[model samples]
Target: MDATSRHSKILDLLNSQERVEVEDLAARFGVSLQTIRTDLRDLSARGVLSRVHGGAVRVSSAANRAYADRRKQNATAKQTMAALLAEFIPDNCSLAINIGTSTEQAARSLENHRGLTVLSNNINIINLMMGGEAKELILVGGTVRQSDGAIIGEDAV
Candidate 1:
């Protein structure tokens, strides 16, 4: 495809998926990795995307990226951090968690925990810890945002 078409396609992919790896984009477009990197750099300069090590992510604003995209972002890092956080959390304790992908990862890490009460405003977290060893799970009363499964009502706060 031409450069114009490639740029448009790249933006479309970023909008729907929130991230694109240089290798994948190169393979898809049948171009060199350097071409994709140059395109990403140009897009980044235009304030539409942000370049990372081997990929580019959609420019996140105060509103945040799509929920699915957020979950995929730095997932491995989140899992590692969550494991460390879990180590600090002793058993037989009441713990509260907030909404977001990192918090969800933390919840997964704490699944094997015993004698623990988990209170959260994230619907996903409530579901994730259900089959775990947590003694109790509490979900705050709020309006559930369907897009991200976040509870965001007055009662939640």
Candidate 2:
């Protein structure tokens, strides 16, 4: 394709990654090193990217969050699961739940149900249920697992 298209594509790839190797780009786009170099040069001239050793980094790369840290970035799935779990809860009935992140999501989903008794070993679930339609919130007190914020031990059983 043309230089403009190639430059745009290079910018797109750079946007997706903090650093992209020239060899990988060359293979992905079926182009030679010289062609990739020319595109990188054009992007650099436009101040859209800075050419690093064997790769290019986007101008905004410094502000982008690393992929490893972004694994827990959005909790959209959790929120959706919470909302869906609301449907299974019957009003004024007692429900027993385990200690887990997903279980907390299920408890959060029950926010709209009225006069419901929720028994859980999850601190987050108890806290969330405190101000909602929960008629009664029973927390099986025990040692809380800090890693996942779940209560676990003999007391929780």
Candidate 3:
């Protein structure tokens, strides 16, 4: 496979396995060790993964992937879950939500509901709900997490 395809496949493996060794990647892709090393180096430089001694692990803080990558990952599945959640949540009801990509999807799914009040610490969810889906949107006050647009602290609690 080509470099782009190889990189995507490597990320997929990391999603399932959490870490990947250079030798294993080289074997799986039928590439040389040097090629696998180069790929790992490039991905690490891009801040997508962290290079270890003989392998790379997902670049994560608080066990959360990079915000952009997380947004792209499992999008359809997230949507499906959000739709199911919305089915159980009646219109004109109040909802409290936390931060994460899945919560963002839930906010999106609830956009069509009427007379909804949403309280959240997730900035992305607030923004998504601001398209007038919710009758009221309350954001918790706290320090904003630059990595994922989440507000956290005692104030948020």
lDDT of 3 at 3: 93
Name the runs in model 2 displaced over 4 angstroms: 1-74
Best model number under lDDT? 3
**How many collisions per candidate?**
0, 1, 0
lDDT of 1 at 61: 60
Candidate 1 local distance difference test against the native:
0.89
What's each prediction's TM-score? 0.62, 0.49, 0.61
lDDT: which is higher, 1 or 2? 1
RMSD of each: 8.6, 13.0, 9.3
lDDT of 1 by residue, 15-129 (tens): 7896799999999999999999999888888888889999999888634578888889888999999999999999999989998899999999988889999899999998999
Give lDDT for model 2: 0.75
At residue 128, candidate 2 shows an lDDT of 74
- Full-model lDDT for every candidate: 0.89, 0.75, 0.90
Tell me how far the alpha carbon of residue 79 in candidate 1 is from the true structure, in angstroms, after superposition.
0.8
Candidate 3 lDDT score at position 4: 95
Worst 10 residues of 2 by lDDT: 62-71
Candidate 2: C-alpha RMSD to true structure equals 13.0
